[model samples]
Target chain A: MTVAADQPTALIRLGRFLRDNPVIPLILLLFVLIGVLEYMRPGIVNERWIGNTIKFAIPLAMLAACQTITMLTGGIDLSVGVVATVSAFVVSSLTPLLGAPSAVTISLAAAVLVGLVNGFGVGICRVHPLIMTLGTGLIATGCLQVYQRFVIATGSEIPSFLEWLGTGRTFSLPNALFLFLPFAALILWGLARTGFGRLLYAIGANENAAKLSGVRSWQVFLALYTLSALIAGITGLLYVGMIRAPSLSLANPLLLPSVAAAVIGGTSIFGGRGGYSGTIVGALILTVLGTLLTLLQMPEGARRLLFGLIILAVTALYVRFTDQS
Target chain B: MTGFLKKHGWTLGLLAILLTLLIAIRVVQPNFGASGLESLARAALPFAFATAAMAVVVIAGGIDLSVASMMAVTGVTAAVLMDNATEGQAVFAVIAVLLVGIAMGAINGALIVLTKVPDIVVTLAMLFVWEGVALLILSTPGGGAADWLRSIIAGPVSLPFLPEAWTFWLPNAFIFMAVAIAVIWLPLRRSKLGLSIYAIGSDDTAAFRSGIAIGRTRVAAYAVAGLFCALGGLSLTMGTGIGEPVPGPYLMASVAAVVLGGVVLGGGRGGLLGPIIAVFILRAIRLLLTLMAVDPNVTTIVEGTIMVVVVMLGAILMMRERRS
Candidate 1:
């Protein structure tokens, strides 16, 4: 009788825990999806598969970091994809001539320059983030094309360190975790604990109010975009290492998916809410879904159609559930 | 004069820029003639229509990233239906294609309303969905258009009773553009739905409090945008005489045109006329770049730079005006 009475309290406690942490449901959903994938193809969810999934998902999650941080300020960085491509292309082409370290440094610097321009446009000039980033992205693409002409004669080389981090495995676990874990922990900690991070939320929630409270919103924007672009540059390096190829459009395909991941992870596009923890789960979910689609052997068109449908469905359901309790 | 300038300064500024570009083209290519203008008009039809579509939705405080995909889908649908068809059948095919576009747009509107998803996310999803559908319709970039339909859209106007000088420089596409403006834009501008769109975009809560049907008006705005996209697709079909599954450079170009045209991105402050003119300006810039024999890669840089400069100028102007 005492055990039966305690069971009701435990059930209530679990329910309260889930309600307090919405990310729990998403986590549960991720596991459910993995189970479905395993059931579909018996023994497919092995250590190797897990490593590959994490390997591919890292670049995407890193790119999504740009979106999540920007979206927190009620803005977006549409140029992140191009930034990644530029970084990857530049680093690869320069590695042959400048050595890997300096090439990586210069490529990251280029990304910072682009980010500075974006920040100036959005923060100082008061241009909308979408237009500012789009214009900057276009300019970057154009610059890349011109740069390509000069670099066409030179061969590209992926940096050895990046390659190891991107593709190497340690005890059946991805080596990328060495990089990602620290990066994610820093972001999570920074966002939750730092005054600068709180400023982002304040500015996103209401710029005027934040300004009234002496937030210096423009400075925040400047730093935020610069940091976001730097992250994108890092993602590019890792992506090139993983794919072992660099092209003008290397990271373009991940652009929309990154945004979707952030949105699915419960970051409000309008801003003022959400955390990096949810976005990490979101990235994992998309990677698993991609694997499932590939295993289904569907045509490209059907694959895209289903991908869109599932994102829509998942976002809708996620929103519905979260909104209620 | 100051009052007049204050009222129409933006339009006048745009016109001056356009004239400068045209003059520059004339100076660069001494042989630039009526035929060159005609060809430019023909080339610009698709962009103008597409920009108009973007502008309308943007004015309603939403962005549809799928406009280019919608154009591709509708264009391919038209191509498949009108291939080898007679004149009457081609007309039917045209109407059906437009309906298809409107239907697709309505679905977008309904989904956004029902799901409470942000406009950008829903449209972003639809961008892939529609592109996928386009691929399914034409696995490759190959589909035919009716001969008469092509001639009507892209052919030169040749009125037998008119003077050769008057008729030779006119493109049939220009007439279609004028008809579309007359039939769609002007009426929509003066309609209640149009006012509601502006109202909602400017302030949805206030609009809701004022008893405006936000959902229906938003749907109508999207549907109108879809119709314009259909027109753009039809222009593409006529210009190319075939269906192309890929959207090409039109998507970014359309958005750039909208922003450059002085329409505020958050909506409710711009007009279609500005964007239409902006399209010609963009085309003229391209033509000038080509005439100057600049590297094609550099042309994109120039275009993007010009976009940034123009918007920056607009921002500065607004700031000054506000201060004064």
Candidate 2:
């Protein structure tokens, strides 16, 4: 349908404005925040710092896209961090078996299976999203640990392909960015262009109404959860390729970066509203903010407190200004 | 029997477990003896503080996953304050830590109440914030506590009367819990604010219509939870003899204990007594694994597995009741 034809009446005109205008303000906000930081310190936009910001943004970029996909259907996969962990371990284990190609396939397959199970458990069983995913995420990590300890062994793994994944780049861009091309294009097309994309927004907007209006409820649930898992799995596997192990293989605590990344990206926690496009922006903002703070040698724990405070503040503002309910 | 089972259910099951494990220990090491009763006091102490803290939030139908980080933050801050402060200043640091808990928690409550944001999300954000702070401050996994404080907390306290042999095996944390239970729990239970905490959790709109201040109650509930978390954090500070950034397991472990104590996650139900027992039972599992000399990795696996089973069991029980 034509853009004008698809536009809603006066009631929804404001929504369309929001959906369209959200990104510009966000990008501007980033610039403004950066400008202030730079003014205070001067030269944050220097070439080297810019380069570092891109590098910093890569991992979170992978995470945001993954998180955004699931969030589109109104769910958050707490397992993304663990998925990063499992992928790393699998890569380390598989490198010597049939080489990286086979290992990559195994990792992807595992992610698909996990995604399916997560989808089915959440969508069909109708378990609370947080608990279902948390339970499964725990089990996945435990099994990985079991495999790491007894089955495979856990230690330093600098698998050859992993180095390529983590460090490889073309000209100036990360090779990981290349991996996201298919995901970004597919997601943009699926969510914004295709019938299924419309279905997802519809489902997210109101699951009951969507179902009553002929949406295949369970199928939609299955699709969103699975898609969310697949994206996370890809990010995880790619991360392993980069780091040569799971993110958790290094054991940075599972606080709420991925979750916050999604939220800060402007994805609604209540569901039925969000875009991966904004998630990318949010992740970038976070990386820059983090790096800048790190430069001053601020205590790491202090940053977490700040991160939490910001989320609370942003959420409060969004609710007051936007929700008013 | 069922009535008794329902009332004393979580408590009975947990005590049975504690007895069986202690008996098992008696058989295994025989002289793994009464002197070791200190282990129970220390083991249960941190969770006792956390679970009580969590009870308030849960009473308002919210959860504070950040308690561990708060625990770590408090632990780290307490350690830092110990070195610089005069005795008087050290006392202020302790109070300061509790205030931080209350403040951190109040933020969660207010955010959830005002934005109608989910408790899970707000707490999740707080979780990150707290842990990140812990990471920067501690830097390393941990550092040692003040000598005087550790000695008093870890050392035995003698009572006056019959003999030194008749003394209770009370750790400082256990004593703290006793004082907190009296100061925090007793009046809280009988307060109008306390009853309203349950009311809001059970049904916010209904509570509001009945003239309860839903928003304020929720905020107060989470704030109060913060206070308990600070105490729990203090216990962690005491038990570990210092601050360590690795409070993740303790946090989740307390959650499992809270769940076991028959305090359902959805709130407006369950009691502090339930979580206390669950925490003790969970600690016994770790203790059992220690006695078995099972790998720490294996212990982690068991902890996660047990958590899933218990949660699933609770869900199943709920569904069964709903179906019937």
DockQ winner: 1
Shift in Å, residue B30, candidate 2: 4.1
DockQ of each candidate relative to the true complex:
0.65, 0.40
Clashing residue pairs for model 1: none
Candidate 1 on B184-203: residue-level lDDT in tens? Answer: 98988898988998987888
* TM-scores vs. true structure, each candidate: 0.95, 0.84
Compared with the true structure, what per-residue lDDT tens digits does model 1 show for residues A1-325? 3463568666556555644675887898889989999999999989899888888888889999999999999998999999999999999999999999899999999999999998988888888888888899989999999999999999989889988987889998888889899999989999999998899899989999999988888799899999999999998888888888899999988999999889888888888888888899899999998888888988777777788888888777766555643
Instruction: Give me the displacement of residue A143 in model 1, in angstroms.
Output: 0.5
Superposed by TM-score, candidate 1 places the C-alpha of residue B146 at a distance from the truth, in angstroms, of: 0.7
Candidate 2 Cα misplacement greater than 4 A, ranges: A1-16, A34-52, A72-74, A112-127, A150-165, A192-226, A244-248, A251-255, A296-302, B7-11, B14-30, B84-93, B111-118, B128-175, B243-248
State the lDDT of candidate 2 residue by residue for A1-325, as single tens digits.
2464465464256445655556665687678768867877876677666655665576677667666766666766776667666766676676676577877778777767767766776676665566556666766776786677653443445466557756776666666666666767777777788887788778767888998899887787787777766666666666666654444454223225667767777777657777877777777778767765666666766766676777766655544434531
